[model samples]
Target: MRNLCMKVNYDGTEYDGFQTQPNGNTIQDYLESAICSLTGERLKITGSGRTDAGVHAYGQVFNFHTESPIPIERWCLALNAWLPRDIIVTDAREVPLTFHARRMAKRKTYRYSINANRFPDIFHRRTQAHHPTKLDVQAMEQGLAHLIGTFDYTSFASRRSQKTNHVRTIYEAYMTVDHSFSRPGSDDQGIIHTYITGSGFLQHMVRIIMGTLLEVGEGKKSADDIPFILEAKNRSKAGPTAVGHALTLWSVEYEENIKKH
Candidate 1:
Protein backbone atom coordinates (compact mmCIF):
# COMPACT_ATOMS: atom_id res chain seq x y z
CA MET A 1 0.00 0.00 0.00
CA ARG A 2 1.12 3.51 -0.78
CA ASN A 3 0.22 6.59 1.21
CA LEU A 4 -1.13 9.27 -1.05
CA CYS A 5 -1.87 12.86 0.01
CA MET A 6 -4.49 15.00 -1.67
CA LYS A 7 -5.46 18.65 -1.57
CA VAL A 8 -9.16 19.34 -1.80
CA ASN A 9 -11.57 22.28 -2.03
CA TYR A 10 -15.11 22.18 -0.80
CA ASP A 11 -18.06 24.51 -0.44
CA GLY A 12 -19.02 23.18 2.99
CA THR A 13 -22.46 24.83 2.87
CA GLU A 14 -24.27 21.64 1.90
CA TYR A 15 -22.42 19.00 3.92
CA ASP A 16 -22.24 18.40 7.66
CA GLY A 17 -18.44 18.68 8.18
CA PHE A 18 -15.12 16.98 7.54
CA GLN A 19 -15.41 14.14 10.04
CA THR A 20 -17.77 11.25 9.35
CA GLN A 21 -20.97 10.71 11.30
CA PRO A 22 -23.74 8.15 11.08
CA ASN A 23 -26.42 9.25 8.54
CA GLY A 24 -24.67 12.58 7.98
CA ASN A 25 -22.83 13.71 4.83
CA THR A 26 -19.08 14.32 5.26
CA ILE A 27 -15.90 14.85 3.21
CA GLN A 28 -14.15 11.72 4.41
CA ASP A 29 -17.02 9.42 3.52
CA TYR A 30 -17.17 10.85 0.03
CA LEU A 31 -13.41 10.55 -0.52
CA GLU A 32 -13.31 7.01 0.82
CA SER A 33 -16.27 5.99 -1.28
CA ALA A 34 -14.80 7.50 -4.39
CA ILE A 35 -11.42 5.95 -3.78
CA CYS A 36 -12.93 2.59 -2.99
CA SER A 37 -15.01 2.62 -6.12
CA LEU A 38 -12.00 3.55 -8.20
CA THR A 39 -9.42 1.32 -6.53
CA GLY A 40 -11.53 -1.58 -5.23
CA GLU A 41 -10.12 -1.11 -1.73
CA ARG A 42 -11.99 0.43 1.16
CA LEU A 43 -9.39 2.70 2.68
CA LYS A 44 -9.42 4.79 5.80
CA ILE A 45 -8.60 8.40 5.03
CA THR A 46 -7.34 10.91 7.59
CA GLY A 47 -7.56 14.67 7.21
CA SER A 48 -5.12 17.31 8.42
CA GLY A 49 -7.83 19.06 10.44
CA ARG A 50 -11.53 18.99 11.13
CA THR A 51 -13.60 21.90 9.88
CA ASP A 52 -17.07 22.60 11.23
CA ALA A 53 -20.22 22.34 9.21
CA GLY A 54 -20.79 25.15 6.69
CA VAL A 55 -17.09 25.96 6.70
CA HIS A 56 -15.43 26.11 3.29
CA ALA A 57 -11.91 25.26 2.08
CA TYR A 58 -9.62 26.29 -0.73
CA GLY A 59 -6.91 23.77 0.09
CA GLN A 60 -7.86 21.20 2.74
CA VAL A 61 -5.73 18.04 2.77
CA PHE A 62 -6.04 14.35 3.59
CA ASN A 63 -4.14 11.09 3.12
CA PHE A 64 -4.95 7.42 2.80
CA HIS A 65 -3.13 4.13 2.12
CA THR A 66 -4.37 2.10 -0.82
CA GLU A 67 -3.28 -1.06 -2.58
CA SER A 68 -4.14 0.22 -6.04
CA PRO A 69 -1.38 1.16 -8.47
CA ILE A 70 -3.20 4.17 -9.88
CA PRO A 71 -1.01 7.17 -10.55
CA ILE A 72 -1.31 10.38 -8.52
CA GLU A 73 -2.92 12.16 -11.48
CA ARG A 74 -5.65 9.56 -11.58
CA TRP A 75 -6.45 10.22 -7.93
CA CYS A 76 -7.48 13.79 -8.71
CA LEU A 77 -9.07 12.92 -12.04
CA ALA A 78 -11.04 9.91 -10.88
CA LEU A 79 -12.06 11.46 -7.56
CA ASN A 80 -13.19 14.67 -9.19
CA ALA A 81 -15.14 12.68 -11.72
CA TRP A 82 -17.04 10.82 -9.00
CA LEU A 83 -17.24 13.35 -6.16
CA PRO A 84 -20.20 15.71 -5.78
CA ARG A 85 -20.22 19.25 -7.14
CA ASP A 86 -19.68 20.88 -3.73
CA ILE A 87 -16.31 19.13 -3.36
CA ILE A 88 -13.33 18.75 -5.68
CA VAL A 89 -9.97 17.01 -5.43
CA THR A 90 -7.48 19.65 -6.51
CA ASP A 91 -4.15 17.85 -6.27
CA ALA A 92 -2.57 14.57 -5.22
CA ARG A 93 0.88 13.14 -4.68
CA GLU A 94 2.60 10.12 -3.17
CA VAL A 95 4.27 10.42 0.23
CA PRO A 96 6.54 8.45 2.57
CA LEU A 97 4.95 5.43 4.23
CA THR A 98 5.06 6.89 7.71
CA PHE A 99 4.05 10.46 6.79
CA HIS A 100 0.75 11.43 8.32
CA ALA A 101 -1.14 14.37 6.87
CA ARG A 102 -2.20 15.81 10.23
CA ARG A 103 1.03 15.08 12.11
CA MET A 104 3.62 16.20 9.55
CA ALA A 105 2.07 19.55 8.71
CA LYS A 106 4.32 22.50 9.56
CA ARG A 107 1.71 25.25 9.45
CA LYS A 108 -1.90 25.91 8.55
CA THR A 109 -3.53 28.94 6.95
CA TYR A 110 -7.11 30.09 7.46
CA ARG A 111 -9.06 32.97 5.98
CA TYR A 112 -12.15 34.70 7.38
CA SER A 113 -14.42 37.16 5.62
CA ILE A 114 -16.79 39.76 7.08
CA ASN A 115 -19.07 41.97 5.02
CA ALA A 116 -19.35 45.15 7.09
CA ASN A 117 -21.88 46.89 4.89
CA ARG A 118 -25.64 47.35 4.89
CA PHE A 119 -26.29 45.74 1.52
CA PRO A 120 -25.64 42.05 1.07
CA ASP A 121 -24.04 40.52 -1.98
CA ILE A 122 -25.47 37.30 -3.34
CA PHE A 123 -22.14 35.77 -4.30
CA HIS A 124 -20.50 36.60 -1.00
CA ARG A 125 -23.51 35.92 1.22
CA ARG A 126 -22.59 32.24 1.54
CA THR A 127 -18.92 32.93 2.32
CA GLN A 128 -18.76 36.22 4.23
CA ALA A 129 -20.48 37.10 7.48
CA HIS A 130 -22.25 40.43 7.67
CA HIS A 131 -21.86 43.22 10.21
CA PRO A 132 -24.44 45.99 10.43
CA THR A 133 -22.25 49.02 11.09
CA LYS A 134 -19.00 50.31 9.67
CA LEU A 135 -15.86 49.34 11.56
CA ASP A 136 -13.06 51.72 12.50
CA VAL A 137 -10.24 50.53 10.21
CA GLN A 138 -7.53 52.14 12.31
CA ALA A 139 -8.67 50.36 15.44
CA MET A 140 -8.88 47.10 13.54
CA GLU A 141 -5.28 47.54 12.41
CA GLN A 142 -4.22 48.21 15.97
CA GLY A 143 -5.80 44.96 17.12
CA LEU A 144 -4.15 43.06 14.28
CA ALA A 145 -0.74 44.50 15.06
CA HIS A 146 -1.17 43.71 18.73
CA LEU A 147 -2.24 40.16 17.86
CA ILE A 148 1.02 39.37 16.03
CA GLY A 149 3.28 36.87 17.92
CA THR A 150 3.03 33.77 20.06
CA PHE A 151 0.46 33.77 22.87
CA ASP A 152 -2.14 31.72 24.68
CA TYR A 153 -5.40 31.50 22.73
CA THR A 154 -7.62 30.34 25.56
CA SER A 155 -9.87 33.38 25.40
CA PHE A 156 -10.68 32.67 21.73
CA ALA A 157 -11.95 29.13 22.15
CA SER A 158 -15.22 27.48 23.03
CA ARG A 159 -15.85 26.70 26.68
CA ARG A 160 -17.15 23.23 25.85
CA SER A 161 -13.78 22.14 24.44
CA GLN A 162 -11.38 20.02 26.53
CA LYS A 163 -7.94 21.07 25.29
CA THR A 164 -6.04 22.42 28.31
CA ASN A 165 -2.98 23.91 26.64
CA HIS A 166 -4.09 27.21 25.11
CA VAL A 167 -0.72 28.49 24.01
CA ARG A 168 -0.41 28.79 20.19
CA THR A 169 2.04 30.71 18.07
CA ILE A 170 0.56 33.07 15.50
CA TYR A 171 3.22 33.97 12.96
CA GLU A 172 1.11 36.38 10.89
CA ALA A 173 -2.46 37.71 10.98
CA TYR A 174 -3.98 40.72 9.20
CA MET A 175 -7.17 41.93 7.56
CA THR A 176 -7.86 43.77 4.32
CA VAL A 177 -10.75 45.16 2.31
CA ASP A 178 -12.04 43.15 -0.68
CA HIS A 179 -13.54 45.39 -3.33
CA SER A 180 -13.72 42.88 -6.16
CA PHE A 181 -16.75 40.86 -5.02
CA SER A 182 -19.80 42.69 -6.35
CA ARG A 183 -23.35 41.47 -6.67
CA PRO A 184 -26.36 42.81 -8.52
CA GLY A 185 -28.27 45.48 -6.55
CA SER A 186 -25.53 45.44 -3.86
CA ASP A 187 -22.65 47.82 -3.24
CA ASP A 188 -19.30 46.45 -2.06
CA GLN A 189 -18.30 49.51 -0.10
CA GLY A 190 -16.36 48.09 2.83
CA ILE A 191 -16.21 44.32 2.76
CA ILE A 192 -13.41 43.00 4.96
CA HIS A 193 -11.16 40.06 4.13
CA THR A 194 -9.11 38.72 7.02
CA TYR A 195 -6.35 36.13 6.55
CA ILE A 196 -4.37 34.47 9.34
CA THR A 197 -1.58 31.88 9.04
CA GLY A 198 -0.07 30.03 11.94
CA SER A 199 1.47 26.78 13.15
CA GLY A 200 -1.96 25.48 14.07
CA PHE A 201 -5.32 26.67 15.37
CA LEU A 202 -7.39 25.72 18.35
CA GLN A 203 -11.08 24.84 18.05
CA HIS A 204 -13.07 27.88 16.93
CA MET A 205 -9.97 30.00 17.43
CA VAL A 206 -10.16 32.18 14.29
CA ARG A 207 -13.81 33.04 14.68
CA ILE A 208 -13.40 34.06 18.32
CA ILE A 209 -10.39 36.16 17.47
CA MET A 210 -12.30 37.81 14.65
CA GLY A 211 -15.20 38.59 16.96
CA THR A 212 -12.89 40.14 19.57
CA LEU A 213 -11.15 42.21 16.91
CA LEU A 214 -14.49 43.35 15.56
CA GLU A 215 -15.36 44.57 19.03
CA VAL A 216 -12.10 46.46 19.18
CA GLY A 217 -12.77 48.00 15.77
CA GLU A 218 -16.16 49.22 17.01
CA GLY A 219 -14.39 50.97 19.91
CA LYS A 220 -16.10 48.68 22.39
CA LYS A 221 -12.86 46.87 23.35
CA SER A 222 -9.37 48.24 23.64
CA ALA A 223 -6.49 46.75 21.68
CA ASP A 224 -4.54 46.45 24.92
CA ASP A 225 -7.19 44.06 26.26
CA ILE A 226 -5.89 41.23 24.04
CA PRO A 227 -2.97 40.46 26.34
CA PHE A 228 -5.18 40.47 29.40
CA ILE A 229 -7.64 38.11 27.74
CA LEU A 230 -4.80 35.73 26.92
CA GLU A 231 -3.64 35.84 30.52
CA ALA A 232 -7.14 35.22 31.83
CA LYS A 233 -7.27 31.77 30.24
CA ASN A 234 -11.06 31.96 30.34
CA ARG A 235 -13.14 31.25 27.29
CA SER A 236 -15.78 33.74 28.40
CA LYS A 237 -13.32 36.65 28.33
CA ALA A 238 -13.29 36.87 24.53
CA GLY A 239 -16.10 37.93 22.21
CA PRO A 240 -18.52 35.42 20.74
CA THR A 241 -17.09 33.10 18.10
CA ALA A 242 -18.25 33.82 14.57
CA VAL A 243 -20.24 31.34 12.51
CA GLY A 244 -18.52 28.52 10.60
CA HIS A 245 -19.68 29.58 7.15
CA ALA A 246 -17.25 32.49 6.99
CA LEU A 247 -14.16 30.43 7.80
CA THR A 248 -12.05 28.51 5.26
CA LEU A 249 -8.94 26.37 5.46
CA TRP A 250 -6.92 28.21 2.86
CA SER A 251 -3.86 25.91 2.76
CA VAL A 252 -1.41 23.74 4.66
CA GLU A 253 2.35 23.74 4.61
CA TYR A 254 4.12 20.40 4.51
CA GLU A 255 7.68 19.48 5.44
CA GLU A 256 10.29 20.52 2.83
CA ASN A 257 11.15 16.94 1.83
CA ILE A 258 7.55 15.91 1.21
CA LYS A 259 6.96 15.09 -2.45
CA LYS A 260 5.22 17.88 -4.35
CA HIS A 261 4.18 18.00 -7.97
Candidate 2:
Protein backbone atom coordinates (compact mmCIF):
# COMPACT_ATOMS: atom_id res chain seq x y z
CA MET A 1 0.00 0.00 0.00
CA ARG A 2 1.16 3.54 -0.75
CA ASN A 3 0.76 6.26 1.86
CA LEU A 4 -0.71 9.29 0.14
CA CYS A 5 -1.02 12.85 1.44
CA MET A 6 -3.43 15.42 0.10
CA LYS A 7 -4.25 19.09 0.54
CA VAL A 8 -7.99 19.78 0.62
CA ASN A 9 -10.12 22.91 0.45
CA TYR A 10 -13.74 23.09 1.46
CA ASP A 11 -16.65 25.28 2.33
CA GLY A 12 -17.84 23.94 5.70
CA THR A 13 -21.24 25.63 5.60
CA GLU A 14 -23.40 22.66 4.57
CA TYR A 15 -21.50 19.80 6.19
CA ASP A 16 -21.39 18.83 9.83
CA GLY A 17 -17.60 19.26 10.08
CA PHE A 18 -14.32 17.73 9.02
CA GLN A 19 -14.61 14.53 11.01
CA THR A 20 -17.12 11.78 10.32
CA GLN A 21 -20.16 11.33 12.50
CA PRO A 22 -22.96 8.77 12.81
CA ASN A 23 -25.03 10.67 10.25
CA GLY A 24 -22.05 10.57 7.80
CA ASN A 25 -22.50 14.08 6.39
CA THR A 26 -19.01 15.53 6.75
CA ILE A 27 -15.97 16.35 4.60
CA GLN A 28 -14.19 13.16 5.61
CA ASP A 29 -17.30 11.09 5.00
CA TYR A 30 -17.48 12.35 1.43
CA LEU A 31 -13.74 11.90 0.79
CA GLU A 32 -13.72 8.32 2.05
CA SER A 33 -16.81 7.39 0.10
CA ALA A 34 -15.50 8.96 -3.08
CA ILE A 35 -12.17 7.16 -2.80
CA CYS A 36 -13.89 3.87 -2.17
CA SER A 37 -16.22 4.31 -5.11
CA LEU A 38 -13.33 5.23 -7.40
CA THR A 39 -10.75 2.63 -6.31
CA GLY A 40 -13.05 -0.14 -5.08
CA GLU A 41 -11.10 -0.22 -1.84
CA ARG A 42 -12.44 1.01 1.48
CA LEU A 43 -9.94 3.15 3.36
CA LYS A 44 -9.81 5.70 6.12
CA ILE A 45 -8.38 9.22 5.81
CA THR A 46 -6.71 11.06 8.69
CA GLY A 47 -6.87 14.84 8.74
CA SER A 48 -4.44 17.31 10.29
CA GLY A 49 -7.17 18.40 12.74
CA ARG A 50 -10.85 18.73 13.32
CA THR A 51 -12.71 21.87 12.20
CA ASP A 52 -15.95 22.69 13.96
CA ALA A 53 -19.21 22.85 12.08
CA GLY A 54 -19.72 25.92 9.87
CA VAL A 55 -15.97 26.60 9.84
CA HIS A 56 -14.00 26.59 6.58
CA ALA A 57 -10.53 25.46 5.44
CA TYR A 58 -8.31 26.85 2.72
CA GLY A 59 -5.36 24.45 3.07
CA GLN A 60 -6.38 21.41 5.09
CA VAL A 61 -4.16 18.32 4.90
CA PHE A 62 -5.02 14.63 5.19
CA ASN A 63 -3.35 11.25 4.65
CA PHE A 64 -4.55 7.80 3.75
CA HIS A 65 -3.18 4.46 2.59
CA THR A 66 -4.43 3.01 -0.65
CA GLU A 67 -3.61 0.03 -2.87
CA SER A 68 -5.01 1.61 -6.01
CA PRO A 69 -2.85 2.02 -9.12
CA ILE A 70 -3.71 5.68 -9.58
CA PRO A 71 -0.80 8.10 -10.02
CA ILE A 72 -0.14 10.61 -7.26
CA GLU A 73 -0.69 13.58 -9.54
CA ARG A 74 -4.07 12.26 -10.67
CA TRP A 75 -5.51 11.86 -7.19
CA CYS A 76 -6.69 15.45 -7.13
CA LEU A 77 -8.53 15.13 -10.40
CA ALA A 78 -10.00 11.76 -9.51
CA LEU A 79 -11.21 12.88 -6.11
CA ASN A 80 -12.63 16.13 -7.38
CA ALA A 81 -14.49 14.26 -10.09
CA TRP A 82 -16.24 12.18 -7.45
CA LEU A 83 -16.58 14.48 -4.42
CA PRO A 84 -19.07 17.29 -3.94
CA ARG A 85 -18.42 20.74 -5.38
CA ASP A 86 -17.97 22.26 -1.93
CA ILE A 87 -14.92 20.08 -1.31
CA ILE A 88 -11.91 19.87 -3.63
CA VAL A 89 -8.58 18.10 -3.44
CA THR A 90 -5.92 20.62 -4.41
CA ASP A 91 -2.71 18.62 -4.29
CA ALA A 92 -1.52 15.07 -3.66
CA ARG A 93 1.75 13.22 -3.18
CA GLU A 94 3.22 10.06 -1.65
CA VAL A 95 4.78 10.27 1.77
CA PRO A 96 6.69 8.01 4.15
CA LEU A 97 4.61 5.32 5.80
CA THR A 98 5.20 6.79 9.27
CA PHE A 99 3.73 10.20 8.43
CA HIS A 100 0.64 11.09 10.44
CA ALA A 101 -1.02 14.32 9.37
CA ARG A 102 -2.06 15.66 12.77
CA ARG A 103 0.90 14.39 14.78
CA MET A 104 3.61 15.65 12.46
CA ALA A 105 2.32 19.12 11.79
CA LYS A 106 4.69 21.90 12.95
CA ARG A 107 2.13 24.69 13.08
CA LYS A 108 -1.43 25.58 12.14
CA THR A 109 -2.93 28.91 11.12
CA TYR A 110 -6.52 30.01 11.75
CA ARG A 111 -8.25 33.23 10.76
CA TYR A 112 -11.47 34.67 12.14
CA SER A 113 -13.22 37.23 9.92
CA ILE A 114 -15.79 39.74 11.10
CA ASN A 115 -18.07 42.02 9.08
CA ALA A 116 -18.46 45.09 11.26
CA ASN A 117 -20.24 47.35 8.81
CA ARG A 118 -23.38 49.30 9.58
CA PHE A 119 -25.27 46.86 7.36
CA PRO A 120 -24.42 43.25 6.67
CA ASP A 121 -22.86 42.25 3.35
CA ILE A 122 -25.30 39.85 1.78
CA PHE A 123 -22.65 38.26 -0.41
CA HIS A 124 -20.46 37.09 2.49
CA ARG A 125 -23.11 36.01 4.94
CA ARG A 126 -21.93 32.42 5.10
CA THR A 127 -18.19 33.00 5.57
CA GLN A 128 -18.00 36.22 7.62
CA ALA A 129 -19.63 36.79 10.99
CA HIS A 130 -21.81 39.91 11.09
CA HIS A 131 -21.04 42.31 13.93
CA PRO A 132 -22.65 45.57 12.89
CA THR A 133 -21.29 47.92 15.53
CA LYS A 134 -18.45 50.30 16.14
CA LEU A 135 -15.29 48.64 17.44
CA ASP A 136 -12.26 50.04 19.20
CA VAL A 137 -9.79 48.18 16.98
CA GLN A 138 -6.74 49.53 18.74
CA ALA A 139 -7.91 48.08 22.04
CA MET A 140 -8.56 44.72 20.38
CA GLU A 141 -5.05 44.74 18.92
CA GLN A 142 -3.59 45.43 22.34
CA GLY A 143 -5.36 42.41 23.80
CA LEU A 144 -4.26 40.14 20.95
CA ALA A 145 -0.63 41.23 21.12
CA HIS A 146 -0.39 39.92 24.68
CA LEU A 147 -1.32 36.43 23.50
CA ILE A 148 1.81 35.88 21.37
CA GLY A 149 3.70 33.53 23.64
CA THR A 150 3.50 30.26 25.53
CA PHE A 151 0.84 30.31 28.23
CA ASP A 152 -2.08 28.46 29.71
CA TYR A 153 -4.93 29.30 27.34
CA THR A 154 -7.50 27.67 29.57
CA SER A 155 -9.27 30.99 30.04
CA PHE A 156 -9.99 31.14 26.31
CA ALA A 157 -10.76 27.46 25.87
CA SER A 158 -14.24 26.07 25.83
CA ARG A 159 -15.63 23.94 28.64
CA ARG A 160 -16.79 21.47 26.00
CA SER A 161 -13.18 20.54 25.25
CA GLN A 162 -11.88 17.42 26.98
CA LYS A 163 -8.18 18.32 26.77
CA THR A 164 -6.72 18.40 30.27
CA ASN A 165 -3.68 20.54 29.48
CA HIS A 166 -4.62 23.97 28.21
CA VAL A 167 -1.05 25.16 27.75
CA ARG A 168 -0.04 25.95 24.16
CA THR A 169 2.52 28.16 22.41
CA ILE A 170 1.22 30.84 20.11
CA TYR A 171 3.81 31.73 17.52
CA GLU A 172 2.07 34.76 16.04
CA ALA A 173 -1.13 36.73 16.50
CA TYR A 174 -2.23 39.86 14.65
CA MET A 175 -5.19 41.66 13.14
CA THR A 176 -5.67 43.34 9.74
CA VAL A 177 -8.44 44.75 7.64
CA ASP A 178 -8.99 42.98 4.27
CA HIS A 179 -9.79 45.45 1.54
CA SER A 180 -9.48 43.07 -1.42
CA PHE A 181 -12.78 41.25 -0.97
CA SER A 182 -15.51 43.47 -2.25
CA ARG A 183 -18.73 43.67 -4.27
CA PRO A 184 -18.93 45.34 -7.67
CA GLY A 185 -19.11 48.96 -6.52
CA SER A 186 -18.80 48.84 -2.73
CA ASP A 187 -15.36 48.30 -1.24
CA ASP A 188 -14.71 45.89 1.60
CA GLN A 189 -15.20 48.50 4.32
CA GLY A 190 -15.53 46.65 7.60
CA ILE A 191 -13.88 43.30 7.04
CA ILE A 192 -11.64 42.48 9.97
CA HIS A 193 -9.30 39.48 9.85
CA THR A 194 -7.75 38.22 13.05
CA TYR A 195 -4.97 35.70 12.45
CA ILE A 196 -3.40 33.34 14.97
CA THR A 197 -0.70 30.76 14.27
CA GLY A 198 0.20 28.24 16.95
CA SER A 199 1.78 24.90 17.57
CA GLY A 200 -1.67 23.52 18.25
CA PHE A 201 -5.09 24.68 19.25
CA LEU A 202 -7.66 23.35 21.66
CA GLN A 203 -11.29 23.04 20.67
CA HIS A 204 -12.94 26.37 19.90
CA MET A 205 -9.80 28.21 21.00
CA VAL A 206 -9.70 30.60 18.05
CA ARG A 207 -13.38 31.46 18.29
CA ILE A 208 -13.09 32.10 22.00
CA ILE A 209 -10.11 34.37 21.47
CA MET A 210 -12.01 36.26 18.79
CA GLY A 211 -14.90 36.70 21.20
CA THR A 212 -12.64 38.04 23.92
CA LEU A 213 -11.10 40.50 21.52
CA LEU A 214 -14.51 41.62 20.31
CA GLU A 215 -15.45 42.39 23.88
CA VAL A 216 -12.28 44.43 24.26
CA GLY A 217 -13.12 46.33 21.08
CA GLU A 218 -16.58 47.07 22.47
CA GLY A 219 -15.11 48.42 25.75
CA LYS A 220 -16.69 45.62 27.77
CA LYS A 221 -13.29 44.12 28.51
CA SER A 222 -10.26 46.28 28.92
CA ALA A 223 -7.10 45.43 26.98
CA ASP A 224 -5.06 45.47 30.17
CA ASP A 225 -7.25 42.69 31.59
CA ILE A 226 -5.84 40.15 29.12
CA PRO A 227 -2.83 39.18 31.21
CA PHE A 228 -5.00 38.72 34.27
CA ILE A 229 -7.44 36.58 32.32
CA LEU A 230 -4.63 34.34 31.07
CA GLU A 231 -3.30 33.88 34.58
CA ALA A 232 -6.76 33.12 35.96
CA LYS A 233 -7.02 29.95 33.84
CA ASN A 234 -10.77 30.04 34.30
CA ARG A 235 -13.09 29.82 31.33
CA SER A 236 -15.61 32.19 32.91
CA LYS A 237 -13.03 34.97 32.94
CA ALA A 238 -13.12 35.08 29.14
CA GLY A 239 -15.74 36.61 26.92
CA PRO A 240 -18.48 34.84 25.00
CA THR A 241 -17.61 32.18 22.40
CA ALA A 242 -17.85 33.64 18.93
CA VAL A 243 -19.82 31.88 16.21
CA GLY A 244 -17.99 29.13 14.34
CA HIS A 245 -18.81 30.39 10.86
CA ALA A 246 -16.31 33.23 11.17
CA LEU A 247 -13.40 30.89 11.81
CA THR A 248 -11.31 29.25 9.08
CA LEU A 249 -8.42 26.86 9.24
CA TRP A 250 -6.24 29.02 7.00
CA SER A 251 -3.29 26.66 6.57
CA VAL A 252 -1.22 23.87 8.12
CA GLU A 253 2.57 24.04 8.08
CA TYR A 254 5.02 21.18 8.40
CA GLU A 255 8.78 20.79 8.43
CA GLU A 256 10.52 21.24 5.09
CA ASN A 257 11.57 17.57 4.73
CA ILE A 258 8.15 16.25 5.66
CA LYS A 259 6.52 17.79 2.62
CA LYS A 260 7.52 15.51 -0.27
CA HIS A 261 5.82 17.75 -2.85
Best candidate according to TM-score = 2
| Candidate 2, residue 191: how far the Cα is off, in Å | 0.5
- Regions more than 4 Å wrong, model 2: 180-189
lDDT of 1 by residue, 1-261 (tens): 798889999999988889898976998888888888898887789898888889998999899888888877777888888899889998898888898988887788899988876767777789988885767867877777776788887788787667778778888888788666545465444778888988888889998998888888788898888878888988888888888898999988887887332
TM-score of candidate 2 against the unseen true structure = 0.95
Model 2: lDDT to the true structure: 0.90
TM-score of each: 0.93, 0.95
User: Per-residue alpha-carbon lDDT of model 2 for 76-123, expressed as tens digits?
Assistant: 998999999999999898999998999999899998989877567778
Global lDDT of each candidate: 0.83, 0.90
- Pairs of residues clashing in candidate 1: none
After aligning candidate 1 to the native by TM-score, how far in Å is the CA of 88 from where it should be? 0.3
Clashing pairs in 2: none
